[model samples]
Target: MKIRQKSREFIWGIYDFADTIFSMNVVSLYFPLLIVSDLGGKDIYVGLANSISQLLIVLTAPIFGIFSDRTGKRMPLFIISASLCAIGTLAIGFSAELGAILPVVIAFIFANYFYQLSLTFYNSLLPRVGPESRWGKISGLGTALGYVGSIVGMILVMPFNTGKIFGLNTFIPAGGRIATFTPTAILFAIFALPTLIYYLRDERRSKYPVDTVNRHPFKKIWETFSDTRRYPGIRRFIVSRFFFEEGVETAIVFMGVFAEKVMGMPDSAKIVFFVIATTAAVFGSIIWGKITDWLGPHQSLMLVLYGWIIGLIVLAIFPYRWLFYPIGCWIGIMLGGVWTTSRPYLLKIAPAENVGRYFGLYSLSGKAAAITGPLIWGTIILIFSGWNLFAAYRIAVATLAILIAIGTIILMPNKTLFEKHPIV
Candidate 1:
C-alpha cells in the first residue's frame, strides 16, 4: 500500500512536469516571439490571444468544477482536455508554418483554451494523491518537477531553434522559432501518458460523492459562489488571488517578449537566462514546500506575495542588463513559491467535499485575472508606444508591481479570517 501510494504521488507529479513543458516552451517563451518578431505582429496580438482563451476558461471553469464534484470523476475529463490541448498545440506549429499571422494567433487561442481548461481538472486531483497532511510537500514536489521540466523542455527544444545540442553542430535542421511548436506539442503528449494511464487503470472514486440523479451544475455554481461566506477565508483569498495573479499572468505572457525587445538579448542568451531562473525556481519550490508545511500555507503565501511586490518593483525600475539575471532568478523563485503555497492554501481552508468547486473558483479567479492582465499590459504598451519602447515596457512592469501590492494589502487581513474556519 505504501509503495502504491508513493507511485501514485510520483505519477501525479509527472503530469505537472508534462503540462509545464507546454507552458514554458509554448505559452511563455516561443509563441510570443513567434508572434511579435517572426510573424510581424504586435504585442496586442499576443495579449489578445491570451485574454480570449482565458475568457473562455473563466466562463466554463465553474461549470466544469461542478460537474467534477457531482460525478466524482476527474481523470476522464483531465485526459480529454489534455489530449485536445496537445492537438491544439500541434495545430499552432502547422498554422505558423503557413506564414499567416492570423492562423497562428487563431491556433494559439485554441491551444491555450484547452491548456487552461485541463488545469481545472488537474488541480482538483490533489486530494486524491495523498493524505491532507502531505498535501503541501506533494504540491511542492510537483512544482519543483515542473521547473525541472522547463529546464529539460528548453534544452530539448533548443536544437530546433539553434540546430545544435549543447554547443555541438547537429544534422537536425534549425527551423528557427517555427520549429519549436511541433516538438513541444509532441513532448506534452508523451509526458502526459503516464498519469493518464495510471488514473485510467486505477479507477478509484473520490471520497466525496455527489447526487448524480439531481445534477444541477449551473445552480450549484451559484450556490457555491454564495456559499463562500460560510467558508470564512475563501472569498477573501480568491479576491486576493485575483489581484496578484493578474500580475503573475501578465509577466508570464510578456517576459520573453520583454527580454528580447527591452533587454536586447539574443535567443540563445534568453534561453540561458531562463534556465538560470528556472533553476532558482526548482530550489525555491522545494524549500517553500517545506515552509508551507512548517508555517502553514496562508502565512507562507503572504511571504511569497511580499517577495513578488518587492521583486516586481526592483525589476521595473532597474532594467540594467547586468541586473536581469539576478532579478529573473528572484521572480522565478516567487513564481514557484506562489503556486506551491496557493494550492495547499486553498485545500487547507475549504471543506474536502467541495474541493472541486472551490478549486474551480480558484481557477476562475486566476483566469479572470488572466483575461484582464494581458489586456492591461498591452494597453499600457500601446499607450506608451510613442515614447521610448524600453521605457514603455518598464512602465508596464511598474503597473504590475502596483497590482501585486494591492493584492498583498487585501490578503493581509486574512490571517484572522482563517481562524473562523474549522479546518484551520
Candidate 2:
C-alpha cells in the first residue's frame, strides 16, 4: 500500500478505537446502569431504547448510504454524524437535570442513532482504504485497538462512577449521571477530531456512477434488496447473519443487566468484569483475525459460533459467581471473532461496484437484529420477571443460543460462498 492509504488505515483504526470506547463505556455498559439505577428507570428501558435506536437505523441508514453514493462523498457525512453524536451525548448529560426519563432516553437515542448511522460510511471506506488481501489484518488491528480503547475508556470513567476522582458528585436523586456523560462526550469528541480532520484529505470517494437526479430513496433501497437474488451466497449469509446477530446483539446489550440482576454484582464489579473481558478480546481479535485469513471466513466463523454456544450455555447454567471469571474470557474471545470474521467475509463476497449499497444493506440487516434481539430479550424478561428474575435471564440467553445455532446451521452449507455458481 502507498503511504497515504496506509495513513488512512491508521487514522480510521484510531477512529474505530474511539468509537468502540464510546460504545463499550457508554452504550454497552454504563448507559443501562444509568437508566435503571440513576434515572429510576426500569430494566426493560435498556432493551426498549436499543430497539428504538436500531429501528431508526434500519429506517434511515440506507437513505444516507444512497445519498452518499449519489453525492460521491462520505467523509463529509461522517463528520456531520460525529458532531451530532457529541451534541446528542451532551444533551443526555444535561437531561438528568430535567428530572425526566423521557428526555434522557430521547437524548441517548439521538446520540446512539448518529453513532451507528455513521458506520455505514465508515464500513464503505474499508474496500477503498487498503488492498483487499490485507483487509482482514487492517480490520483485526482496528478491532484490537478498539478493545484497547474499551479498557482505557473503562479506566477513565471509573473515578467518576465511584465518586473517587476530581471529587465529582454527579449522582442522581442528588445531582445526576453527568460525570459519566460529560467525560464520555469530551473523550468521544477529542478522539473523533483526528478522523474528521484527516479523513477529508483521503481520496476514497465513491466509484459507483452517481445518480444525481435519483428520487424515491426508499424505493431505491427496496430495489437494492430485491437485487440480492442475483447473489445467493451473499444473500444466504446475510439472512443467516440476521438471525445470529440478534442473539449476539441481545446478549451483549443485556450482559451488564444480566450481571447486575442475576449475579447480584454492584457497579464496581461490573467495571472490573468488563475490563478483564475486554483484555481477553484484544488477544481474540489478533489471534482469530489470523485464523480468519488462513481458514477463510466460513471455517473461522464456525469455530467462533461454537465458542459462542459454549459461552452462552456456561453463562446460563453456571451457578457460582467464581465461574463467571473464566466465562467472561470466553465471551470476549467470541465477541472479537464474530466481528473480525464477518466483515471480511462480506468484503470477499460483495461486488466491488456496489460496496456502499451492500454494506448499507449489511447495516440494515444488523439493525434488524438489533430490533428483534432486544425486543425479544425484553419481552422475555418482562414475562418471566413476574415468576423469577433469574429465570427470565436464563430463558433469554437460551433463546439467543437457539438463534445462534440456527444461523450456524444455515451458514454451514456455504463452503463456496465466494465462488460463482450457475444461477439457473
Name the best candidate (by TM-score): 1
By summed lDDT, the worst window of 10 consecutive residues in model 1 runs over 415-424
Q: Which residue pairs clash in candidate 1? A: none
Mark the regions of model 2 whose C-alpha exceeds 4 Å error after superposition. Answer: 1-6, 165-177, 204-215, 418-424
Quote the lDDT for 366 in model 2. 90
**Model 1 vs. true fold: TM:** 0.96
Scored against the true structure, residue 101 in model 1 reaches a CA lDDT of 92
lDDT of 2 at 171: 45
lDDT of 1: 0.89
lDDT tens digits, residues 182-283, model 2?
Answer: 778888888877777776765453353455657688888987788788866788788889988999988778888788888898877887888899899989
Task: Give the TM-scores of the predictions, in the order they appear.
Answer: 0.96, 0.92
